[model samples]
Target: MADKRPQRGATLNRESNRFNLPERTADGDWLDDQAGIDGAPPRLRTSVTVERARTIISRNTSPDIGFDRSINPYRGCEHGCIYCFARPTHAFHDLSPGLDFESKLFAKPDAPALLRAELAKRGYSAQPIAFGTNTDPYQPIEAEWRITRGCIEVLSDTDHPLTITTKSDRVLHDIDLLAAMAAKGLAAVALSITSLDPRIAMTLEPRAPTPERRLAAVRKLVAAGIPTHVSIAPVIPAITDHEIEHLVERAAEAGARSVSFIPVRLPWEVAPLFRAWLDAHFPDRAGKVMAIIGAIRDGRDNDPGFFTRMRGSGPWADLLRTRFQIACRKHGLNRERIVLRSDLFRPPEGPQGELFG
Candidate 1:
């Protein structure tokens, strides 16, 4: 079979799992252009599968991460961001970490009920439960599934503290609930804005909301009295790194109370996919970008070490840190961290007769 190019912003034409399976190559006559072979254009459609999870809460012991417990209402994201570090997780389902990770998705409809059950458990303890940690809770699918919204309803009912991180303006749809939770110090949100340049953003994160829309969301959230933060995440070196200061300024101007950033992370299958993206959209500087990234990661494509992973090592990393600090200080970002109150947690009413009995 000839190599089939993916749709714009999509990656990987075929499923390839590097783990628990050996690599396979297809061999046959190749054509320079396979476009008109069948007189039909290749179409990539998003498909969602329902996942019935027994438990909704996931626990992580990694010291590098902030929250210990998180709830992912969905698996896989439709945003099609080439640099998403969570891409490799698709391989566990015998799917490609490339295209399949974005095109194929999973939604957990029972998340709300499961979360309530867990919270009702006798020994359950409440801490900030994070959403959109592994996959975006507000991905396009959420508009239809509403699983994330349902989970939030459960959290809100119990006054359980939680944090959300997303790149979609769909979050605004739940503003009422979020506002109520915020009033009780039970909720906070962070919008991740990678680039303000539309051209770069279009190719980098194809289906996500535009930069302007995200900034608007920050304004809206802040205006509603809900603590809002902006995340200049996955700051690609030689690509989006230059926009750091400007992004911070714009977000801060838009009413974000705090700001944070993370350098691009290429873990597992994400490295190859991101390389392909660079070749497709930024061929001229692709090599230089990777070289700088390697330097930052200590001569590797990625650094998985807990502390070193989030903020890389070496001079490039130091420079980014210095630049970020200067910009934050100049723009008055990160004045304080939003701390949700876990003391307000109260388990929701149990089964109808059980509570009365």
Candidate 2:
């Protein structure tokens, strides 16, 4: 891998639609071609473009997922997680699913207005609106865009139920709004912590905040009377599976109400990208890791079969579930699932107020 793209998670940024992208590359033509006369390539920088969206809330009916609707204020996560399932989405725009998915971002500034309009529709019943299901709502760009903040404000004003999942401590920026809604039984938050080791974390999720900081955020959210959960997501078999018990212990110590784990799932272009990453970072154990994953996935690179997809099938899968259960029981986690209330939701009054009602 000639062009490792320092501080970025991808080893190769191949074209997703080409249909013949290689699994790995020794020479990164894209990076090398950009070299100056002195032969040093320029540092890659993130660029955000504004997207005018007619609608903000997206609906999904997948039985395997927990939420029915979700809102993503931004697209193309800056966290640059090498194993992100959402990476394939970049291909729709004719962009590379690798570096482009993380560096080239889109921000939806009209989300607040769109959300308010949608919530004001006549006879609209409320269910918890999910955030970060596809992309991180509180990624670094949120610090400047504040689009996620705006959407939350609208939800808070209407007393709507909502849930957020993120890896950044940046969610703390809106604790005031979340805590107020939570007091009314309307909000909950989940933070993803894949690995405790900073070195491993950096390579997996290059731009996310450190694991310790995320734990600190859980403590703060819990202290504020907000329902907080810790997620050990995409537990890389050989790489991060070792930290399950340790992460559970830390989450419990941080006052998290519950903890959950999801084994790695590579779908669409993510599989090849992830494979390239393994070759670059864990050459010695890459084959072993993939072999075990195939075992859990039923002899394939991935399994997209309803419930089986979320919780893989096979002895390895059974082992993971048992270990996770033991760890949670020992740490007093996952006693009950967190549920936000919809009874309190009120239709947005709109700028003109409730003229007809």
lDDT score of model 1?
Answer: 0.86
TM-score on alpha carbons, each prediction: 0.93, 0.94
For candidate 2, what is the TM-score? 0.94
Q: Which candidate leads in lDDT?
A: 2
Q: Report per-prediction Cα RMSD to one decimal.
A: 3.2, 2.6
Q: Once superposed on the true structure, which residue ranges of model 1 sit more than 4 Å away at CA?
A: 1-8, 14-17, 22-41, 352-357
C-alpha lDDT values of all predictions: 0.86, 0.90
Clashes of each: 0, 0
Candidate 2 lDDT tens digits, 1-357:
334677788877677765554432322434466444255344567899999999998999999899999999999999999999999888877677888889889999999999999999998889999999999999999999999999999999999999999999999999999999999999999999999999999999999999999999999999999999999998889899888899999999999999988889999889988998998899999999999999999999899999998889999999988899999999889998899999998788765676765
Top candidate (TM-score): 2
Q: Write model 1 residue lDDT over 214-280, tens digit each, in one string.
A: 9999999999989999999999999999999999899889999899888888998888878877877
Error in Å for residue 108 of model 2: 0.3
Worst 10 residues of 2 by lDDT: 22-31
Clashes of 2: 0
Model 2 lDDT vs. the true structure? 0.90
